[model samples]
Target: MNLSVVIPAYRSERWVGRAIRSALAEGVADRNVIVVEDGVLDGTAQVVQATGARLTSLQRNGGAPHARNLGLAQVDTDYVMFLDADDYVENGLLAGLVGALERERADVAIGPWVYDGDGRERGMLRQPPALDNAERIFHWVMHAFFPPCCIAWRADAIRAIGGWDERLRKDQDGELVIRALIRDLKVAVSEQGNGVYWQHDSPHRVTKAQIKDVMYAADVVFAQLEGWVRSRIANGSAGDERVSLGRFCCKTAWVAYAYGDSAAGAKWSAKARELGFHNRGYNYRSALLASVLGIRISSRIKASTRLVYRRIAQR
Candidate 1:
């Protein structure tokens, strides 16, 4: 099967070249590796030209989601994967994922992945198991714990969902997955190959965005999900959409706390409680701790402990 890789690059001259090479090294034709330069016009385009990969440039600076949608519009292959300019695929990874999609007749195929940050391998990350049931799929999409590189999509399936949500500056991948699963798209897992998500402390990293802006973008995403889920319920869908949204709020509270925005964290924690989501262990822990020491103090303690744990894990 013919597969294409669409990499969205924005001021990523330092890493785009290597990302393109990794995709090309997957035995894909150089022309099949498309990089959409997101209007930065930095050395990123020149690097793409040097690698002899197909290059598409936006006239204005759009975020990765826009760049990815533009790149997707140009793909004519049977399958395509949207890879971040800073991340790359393992040899044969793309082909293996495509094979799984074909074998299982699935709309999307997700593969295993590992963390590569600070020039060190952080071991294999957890892979989602079979998404054979709607409940499992909903939970996975809601969490959106995996990066985009771990997934390959049938071009039409993504188009069916109207591509990525350009309104989001972060968590677009997870939001897209939520849309896809809600539409009842078939998903499968590929255990044969893996991708590497390049993590770093770069200020340009989307994850490093200002906390308030991040919260706004996240609110947009969850609001979109809420509208879709409410519609699903009106149509007699099986899942309790509020429960999923509650969990999402709980997770977003964690993000708020991670960035030292205890106010936003408290807001999200309250939203979760308002949704009647007191049973989950995640919500229970945060609510119990916040009620005692207050959100500010409790969040600081949790964030500090998580930072130490993450540092230890990276070692």
Candidate 2:
């Protein structure tokens, strides 16, 4: 099968070369490596040219969603994978994902990934066995287990889904996966750890430091999922819909709290509770704090705690 690897790059001069080299080393003559340079002032363009990859340069920075969409427009391959410029994949990533897709007759296949951050390897990001359907895949995605680099999509399937949402600056990967699952697309999971997600303390990484933007993105995703759940219930496919929505609310609440958005945390947690989701562990703590201290005060507490933790880590 022909595969196209698209790398969305923005100010990624430090790692773009490595990313391009890794994609080239996949050893598929039919494979195409397209790098979308999202208005980089750095030497990212030079690096892409050096590697002889097809380069699409945007006049201004438009985020990963826009860059990926631009890259998708140029794709003529049977399968496509979006690899971030700062990330790399194992040698057999494309072959393994394509093999799984063919064997399982799946429209999309996901492999395991490793997290490399702070000059060290964090660990492997592995999914549970046999996530073979829409509901299970949505559940895993809501919990943030799915990353874009580890996923390969049938070109036709992605085109049918209308590609990525260019409006979202964060959580676009999750949004795309949610859309796929809502369409009841077949998903296959592979055990091979072939994707590497490089996380560094770079201020240029927009998503890493934008807590408010993250919360807004979460709101967008939850709204989309809510609409999908309603449609599913209307169509009599309401299996685990309530539970899944509640779980998603709970997860989003904790993330909001962690990100110093106590108001959103409280709102989502209250919704989860209204849906019969019980408080448990750290979630209970977040819900209680949001309820008792109110949004402004609870947010202050969270921010202060985060500052203290960062200071301690710096020492």
Tens digit of lDDT per residue, candidate 1, span 1-315? 488889998888999988889888887788889899998567888889999999998878888888899899889998999999999888567878988899989989888888887745667565768755456545664544668888999999999999998877876787788778768789888876678898766787887667777898778767766777678778897477677677778778867876888789878878778776653225578768867876566767887997786677666
The local distance difference test score of each candidate is 0.80, 0.77
User: Against the hidden true structure, what lDDT does model 1 obtain?
Assistant: 0.80
Q: Distance (Å) between predicted and true CA of 176, model 2?
A: 0.8
Candidate 2: where are CA atoms >4 Å away? 125-128, 142-144, 278-315
In model 2, the number of clashes is 0
> With candidate 1 superimposed using the best TM-score fit, by how many Å does residue 280's alpha carbon deviate from the native?
9.4
TM-score per candidate, in order? Answer: 0.87, 0.85
lDDT of 2 by residue, 1-315 (tens): 478888999999899888878767875442389999999678899988888889988889988888998999889988889989888887587788888888888888988787765555467566545754655655565544667768999988998998998877777887788778778888887776578888777787855747677777777777877888788789997787776777777777766776767788888878777766765313456558867875456656776887786555544
Which candidate's lDDT is highest?
Answer: 1
Q: What global local distance difference test value does model 2 have?
A: 0.77
TM-score of predicted model 1?
0.87
